[model samples]
Target: MRGAHSTADTAVQAPPHWLRTLALLLICAAYLQGGLVKLFDFGGAVAEMQHFGIAPAEPAAIAVIALELVAPAMIVLGVWRWLAALALAAFTLAATLMANRYWDAPPEARFMLMNAFYEHLGLCGAFLLIVWEDLRARRARRDRAMLAGTKGSALQ
Candidate 1:
């Protein structure tokens, strides 16, 4: 009985590879679209920055577009994913606060802005989960290597 398998354990299964890929793609979808849109329309990007009252609109626009593009790539490729996800989380939170401004919306407009604000906050939470999972995986790998090294030394 000590070595017996549990029914729940047997039933639990990892998702298919394609499904995982699709999920990551969906998470990055908005960022990819925004970056592409901004890259193709420099004037519009600048206008958006200006609309947000960000000084030096062009530089601000360029920086945002760069992060929107770079972070998603790093996340999908598993390269410094924790850092990329953390960056995205911070960016999303900042952008939501700057753009949503639900608290300042008029009575009729408050509902929409409030919804958008919370939706963007949900995105921030997702990005944070990515960061958390990546860091957890890295720590696990480190611990495993250390354990393996100890076992090797014992055998020697």
Candidate 2:
């Protein structure tokens, strides 16, 4: 039955809260470090933005730094996590497309650029996964709340 109860469902164990927090922190570590490094080295950040052909380099650099910092932190803290993860995913895709022009690289540099490009793409995919998980969890909670208000508490 769709609304049948099961001891197996209630018996399922979740990972420890600390472990979950640590995992989230580890996932966001690189971005947090990059953000802090850019914040401390504004000139270098601006130069990077300029290298990527971003106009008004200073403002672009600032915006990048802010996004890099805030999004990762929000994700780790589970505050608007899906939105934060989606923002990071979009930014990663855009930055990777702009900076990792592997197809245009010389033969000698092509391999390295290609690897970097793909790595950034992987990061974008991971961020999107985080977004999906966050939204799924939110929906699950909403469903549970609704069930609690009605005679629908049985596990599916």
Candidate 3:
């Protein structure tokens, strides 16, 4: 008898281009807004950065702005997507570390860092998905080559 099949047991397909585009756009929007907010209120942002041990706040603020603005575009365009993801990973890691170091601070202050870390976690997951698809494609090519080699050897 044919066993009952479960949908959950099937391997899920990779997301369509449109879905990836939508997700990338949403993430980019949030990052762009964050950069803009920090840029517009430099004094307050600088103070916060200093409190977080990010010395020379102006440069750090500019780097954050540049990363947010450029990386989002790169990710959305699918141009250098992996590099953008890596840069974002690094940025989030720094933010997380800073938050951990200042764990004794007020709860509200700690929350901000936690939020950054959570967002980073999501981004990292997306990056992994992309990489998995790439590796799967390579594995399929290798399998095809091996099958062809076996068939050719059997004919000899």
Each prediction's RMSD over C-alphas, in Å, is: 2.4, 4.8, 5.2
TM-score of model 2 vs. true structure: 0.86
lDDT by residue for model 1 (1-156), tens: 788888986775757978866787789899999999999999999999999999999999999999999999998888999899899999999999999898999899999999999999999999898889889879989999999999999999
lDDT of 2 by residue, 22-62 (tens): 88787788789999999999999999988887899999999
Kindly report which residue pairs in candidate 2 clash with one another.
none
**Candidate 3: stretches off by over 4 Å:** 1-14, 100-119, 128-156
Model 3 C-alpha lDDT versus the unseen true structure: 0.73
lDDT: which is higher, 1 or 2? 1
Query: Which candidate gets the maximum lDDT versus the true structure?
Result: 1
In model 2, where do residues sit more than 4 Å from their true spots? 1-12, 151-156
Q: In model 2, what lDDT does residue 60 have?
A: 93
TM-score, per-candidate, Cα-based:
0.90, 0.86, 0.62
Q: What does the lDDT read for residue 137 in candidate 1?
A: 79
In model 1, the runs with Cα more than 4 Å from the true position are 1-13
